[model samples]
Target: MDGKRVLLVEDDSAQSSMLQLELKRRGFRVNAEKTVAAAAARIEKEIFDAVVTDLRLGSGDGLQVVVAVKASQPETGVIVITGHGSIDTAVAAMKAGAFDYLTKPVEPEVLALALRKTIEHRDLVGEVRRLRAEVKERRGVSGIVSASDAMGRVLALVAKVSSTDATVLVTGESGTGKELIARAIHENSPRRDGSFVAINCGALPEGLLESELFGHVKGSFTGADRNKRGLFEEASGGTIFLDEISETTPGLQVKLLRALQEGEIRRVGDNHPVKVSARVVAATNRDLMKQVTAGKFRDDLFYRLKVFPIEIPALRTRVDDVMPLAEAFIKKARVRTGSPATHFSPAAAKALRSYAWPGNVRELEHAVERALIMAGGPTVEARDLPPEIASSAPAKRRVKAKPPRKSRR
Candidate 1:
């Protein structure tokens, strides 16, 4: 508690002096005040670790100081001092935001212990809030590594729409970090404190996908032995990321559209609607407009999901991010793999920069991991890279001719 600041508010001059002396002996820096107005002004001017106020002041009650401290800095803990039979009033003060109460004819030792514990609790709460902020900075827009102007615009769009509840559609090639962008939006949103539920729509069959998304009631299906909540309910108060959303059948899209439009969902077995408040953030490598034109995806649902669209440029188009991204991946892997390699040699760096990463960011991460394993020393040589990435400039020209396409008609 050494050097911790405290606000001491008491009308009795003699008692205030004695208490201040004891607190100072215990290493506290006390700012003493005799009235509620003075203490309130002090609180507004400075932030203290804790405030100890007498319940009865000459001009005003201690509750006023408590309210002032809370309004100015909610994290500051408050301890109210009361006389013999003022227990009810002290309780009311606590309800008004005071942390703890002490009876009159205060014992210095007791007051010291209470202040210590209150300050410790306040510190713990402050630390938790700080960690939450770190999450937003680490996982939010600022954490994304990008050097290309196209990527900068994508991040700017993310920043603009993150604080709003608008539905987000992230269109990009596979392995282009669409999910990462979705997470950035969620972390920076007002719903950051809530759960982030993600499901790959194409990974599950239609029946199972429907059940998994909206949950299932017991006896709804052969394997559903018990009632289960769906992803929408689970993600209530937060954002849900739907990957490969274009893979959904038109039937499932109808349920999804209702959920998005009405803020409600129907479980697979139950007819009664269950309300859900999960924000939707959907991603697809396939173009949904084309899907709509081809009669594969619903146009109404497409428009709903496209309210705030963000398209991540392919890695081949943003070649400037390659080397920096490679170095970042290397640094991130060092702690886990304990790899001695810190960077690539001149030739290896050239290969990494020259190659067209059709697989985008995900592919680059894997390539860096591969190089670390293959390298014999602290510096990774060109031979340590994958065969395609290590090839000459002419070979890259052939590979970069066109992005590999998905197997579809």
Candidate 2:
């Protein structure tokens, strides 16, 4: 057969034989097993592209087969066939790493379609893993530290979009690593070998920002002495990361829209247009939609920048990642300061997770750096944490009390 290798685990002899024959007729190299133990033995000795298993076997539950296949070959797809199918059982199967769940007496065509979809899903996952490994080997993760599912989803989206020349808009709080996301995109994109020019639109005045973005000709202004290349020109054949894009003035927004739409820019004091080839990746902590509604941002520019919108979840929502991020920061801090502090104490970890990180990842990083400096031993204890974090409590809203009424009233 020219199709994939599949292991079919069904307790019933008749059902198992029927499935094996059907799968073989469909071009799959099928191995039929009547028990979970037999399936586990086959998985140990051979690799499969997919596994179709009965949820309840004669000897044991089919979840054991799913676990074994996943443990041995994570790329293998597992589809659970359950006679007693319920939402809870389906959820359990999925949580146990089944690719999909099928109810009892599945139609032959339906089973074939499910197997095809599972194999496709497996291939897609394998491709993502391969791309991630390639990216790590060549360009590192660009210092992006994330272990939470929220960020995992973000990274997956990032990977999928990196191969395209789409304009990306990343929205998050100021210290939530928006620039890091931008860098990761650039590093994994076709423009990896080219320059990645980043400029904060909110960091400069209107006049200077224009000059810096679109370049300036000789004597373009009082301070302009010579012709200078703008960020767009410097980023030709690469990417330009515009941070705090909501801060751009209306006039500058028009220029940005022109560049994004026409792929051309005019230098200051020069009427000649220069063609530039650069991908735009913009970021903002402010709400661009609100800015558009408030007449503070150009609607066209907002649309141009948001071709692919990626919102980063604030660190507070992913508290589970706090300690791992803290540990990573500590490792980097040790390299910078040659400190002996290597880890966080249990109490310190608790304090880190408990605090409301208003400043997000940047705040956590700074806290770790400061704690490393304050720590006198190998580990950072709760006492080493900043008082704001160590003594932090959930924020409470104040309710104003009414003034007491006079008795005469």
Q: Using Cα atoms with residue i matched to residue i, what is each candidate's TM-score against the true structure?
A: 0.73, 0.63
Instruction: Report, for every candidate in turn, its global Cα lDDT versus the true structure.
Output: 0.92, 0.89
Candidate 2: 10-residue stretch with minimal lDDT: 400-409
- Residue 161 in model 2: shift from native, Å? 1.1
> Residue-wise lDDT of candidate 1 within 1-409, one digit each (tens)?
9999988999899999999999999999998999998998889889999999998998698899999989989989999999775778988999999999999789999999999999999989989999988876778777789888889899899989999999999999999999999999999899998989999999999999999899989999998999999999999999999999999999999999999999999998999999999999999999899999999999999999999999999998998888889999999887778889998998888888888888999999999999998887899999999999998433433446566674321
Cα RMSD of all models vs. native, in order, equals 7.2, 17.2
Residue 302 CA displacement from its true place in model 1, Å: 5.0
Report the error of model 2 at residue 145, Å. Answer: 1.5
Residue pairs with backbone overlap in model 2: none
The alpha-carbon deviation from the true structure for residue 98 of candidate 2, after best TM-score superposition, in angstroms, is: 57
Please count the clashing residue pairs in each candidate, in the order shown. Answer: 0, 0
lDDT of 2 by residue, 90-156 (tens): 7888999998999988877788889999898888888998997776664546467778999898999
lDDT of 2 at 348: 83
